[model samples]
Target chain A: MTQPRWLDQTEMAAWRAFLTTSHLLERRIEEQLKATAGLTHPQYEILVRLAAAPGRRLRMTELAEGVVASKSALTYQVGRLEEAGLVERTTCPDDDRGVLAVLTPAGAELLEKVAPGHLEIVREYLIDRLSREELRAMTSAMRKTEAALRSG
Target chain B: MTQPRWLDQTEMAAWRAFLTTSHLLERRIEEQLKATAGLTHPQYEILVRLAAAPGRRLRMTELAEGVVASKSALTYQVGRLEEAGLVERTTCPDDDRGVLAVLTPAGAELLEKVAPGHLEIVREYLIDRLSREELRAMTSAMRKTEAALRSG
Candidate 1:
């Protein structure tokens, strides 16, 4: 029943900025991906992770963790990808109950086709707007925040 | 069709950090809000916005813009809030076709009850982790990005 600590001016400014920036960035990314590739941001992340995996494949659970998505959500997206012939699910070699999401040639090709436009939106809206020093500071701060959230 | 400019190492690192931080932060906020108040983040945002507006009410379109939510999404969340007795929908006095979302006393009470816990998560996971200088950089960088996205 202690008094709650409120955010000071600087903290409030930073918090508001983070909220606004994140919302706008996600919306823009979603719009770009949907228009160009008919994929959601999470779906695009799935494909990118799979494309970079050792054999263009990853276990569903591992992919879910990497993408910060739930297992069920990942399964649903993988199903969509399968229907589109972009990805396939296979039995995991290491565990009977486990399944792997393998990026198909079509998925790879789509990613390759979609990546430049994706990066352009990202760079135009966010990365290119900040100075090197600002980028470094943001990276450092965000890394700290990410680590704390993961551990907590 | 010129070769798309790719991210250099620093840019890539910054971009990844932003993505991971945003995802984790959003997940944490969503989990905390749902657990504490049975509210999703967007629903909570709507309540907060209504609580701050003059007369504790705002036009639906204005609320949507303030929260960076789509009109349909805002309408859906407002509908849920109305059902929960936290908000009410009324015709805007100034405009016949416009609807206003007004926060009830119960809604304000719920926000008062919830704000402390929400701020705690934001502070613990994000604000307290950064130095003042880092926060300034983040705020400035994010502001620039927000402006660009809003204007573009």
Candidate 2:
């Protein structure tokens, strides 16, 4: 195989910093959510996605895709959510094997209760940390990265 | 309680965009690593941390802390790595309950082989996507966020 063009020293530093930051930030957010809302970040993400989707529900496959998780992982997570009464799973009318996850009133209420704290953490850790210019730069950079990865 | 300050439209947009971009970027990196090196991002992170450590080994607790994973999760991951001949576990002489994870020569070789492609993907998705100013801004913002979370 040909030698791959690797990141230079500066680029390597930035990449490592970015990875470390991303991991730590995620852990902080998840820890806060677990303590305050009794929900994992992934669980909260699922609820938020369902709430945003039409009819406040999505098919299992669609939910998996939205969350970028495997079907089995989604199933296990949704099962836990269902047991907690935060979400409901229903058989899809069009396909028996298909299941739709719906955010229940209880789930919506839980999210509503947690939104303030979650938003506050987000503000403190992410939004407030960045200046206007930094925010714009970050968004632009992320978009470029996303586009490149999509093409690659 | 006082009315909690929620993210304004602009901040909300940035937050959501950041989340989406981060998730997609992780997925892209994981896919590339899986295809090229047969290693998940978390596994690669573990290997990298061990490789960077003195003697290319660390206690289970230390490894977990370094990787920001729970003990059980780290145990499971190390088990997988051991099965793959990438790592070995040995009882610590000083601490009976403590175990050391030592990187195998095969593991070090694999890391050396995969580092170039992995760094390239990271550069493509993160470092190269930002300008010098933007990179500085991101690093600064991340540092602030990390400090805030650590202090809080």
The C-alpha TM-scores of every prediction are 0.97, 0.84
Assess each model's interface with DockQ, reporting 2 decimals per model. Answer: 0.87, 0.58
Q: Residue pairs in steric clash, candidate 2?
A: none
**B1-152: candidate 1 lDDT, tens digit per residue:** 67899999999989989998899899999999999999999999898889889999999999998899999999888999999999999999889999999999999999999999999999999999899899999999999999999898
Best by TM-score: 1
lDDT of all predictions = 0.93, 0.85
- List, residue by residue over A34-105, the lDDT tens digit for candidate 1: 999999999999999999899999999889988999888988999999999999989988899989899999
The candidates' interface RMSDs, in order, read 0.7, 1.8
Q: Which stretches in model 2 have alpha-carbon errors above 4 Å?
A: A59-62, A89-100, A150-152, B89-99
lDDT of 2 by residue, B67-149 (tens): 76788999999999999999999999899998999999999999998888888777767787789987877777667776776
Model 1, runs deviating above 4 Å: none
Lowest-lDDT window of 10 residues in candidate 1 chain A? Answer: A65-74
- Clash total of candidate 1: 0
